[model samples]
Target: MRIGELARRCNVSTRALRYYEEQQLLTPGRHPNGYRDYPESAVETVRRIRTLLDAGFNADTIRIVLPCLNGDDVDMCPQVAAAIRDTLHGIDEQLRDLETKRGRITALLAGRQL
Candidate 1:
């Protein structure tokens, strides 16, 4: 299929598909007419990319993890495991910071000067 068909099937914009290609995540071949020709499997690959991006995985991380993905499960190599652990830790730290800010705001709203 072509780029437009891939975008339509994946429900993502052509720009996004191009971005994915630029990120080296999606590899579509070039036609003689200079159009991009994507394999049929690109549909599912795009879906997986979206899912990983939604899960807060960056393009680089997704690139590393893509080949390790098997259906709904990730193969969880050492590097991937470490990356996930780091992401989880970062998220935890952000949650703690947000909780602290929430408490401060609540106190201020309640007229407590602290």
Candidate 2:
């Protein structure tokens, strides 16, 4: 399919698809007329990319992790595991920071000093 069809099927803008291509996240073949020709699987790929982005994975992380996520294999690569672990650690730190901020707000509400 062409880029427009792929974007419509995926519910993403053509600009987003082009950005994905620029980031090396999605690759589309070029037609003789200079149009982009995406494979049928590109639809599913864009869906997965959206899911990952919604989960807070940046393009760099998505680029790193998508291949590991692609196959029917149940196991992931060590690098994938490491990246996940790192992301989890970042989440944990953010949670802790939020908790600390909540505590400070609670103290302020109680008329106590920080």
**Model 2, residue 40: C-alpha shift (Å):** 0.3
1-114: candidate 2 lDDT, tens digit per residue: 998899889899999999999999999999999999898888888988898788777888788888877554424688877877777788899999999999999999999999
Candidate 1's displacement at residue 88, Å, is: 1.3
Candidate 1, residues 5-96: lDDT per residue as tens digits?
99889999999999999999999999999999999999999999999899888898889889899998989889989887877787899899
Which pairs clash (backbone N, Cα, C closer than 3 Å) in model 2?
none
Which stretches in model 1 have alpha-carbon errors above 4 Å?
A: none
lDDT of each: 0.92, 0.86
Best by lDDT: 1
RMSD of each: 1.3, 2.0
**lDDT for model 2:** 0.86
TM-score list, all predictions? 0.91, 0.84
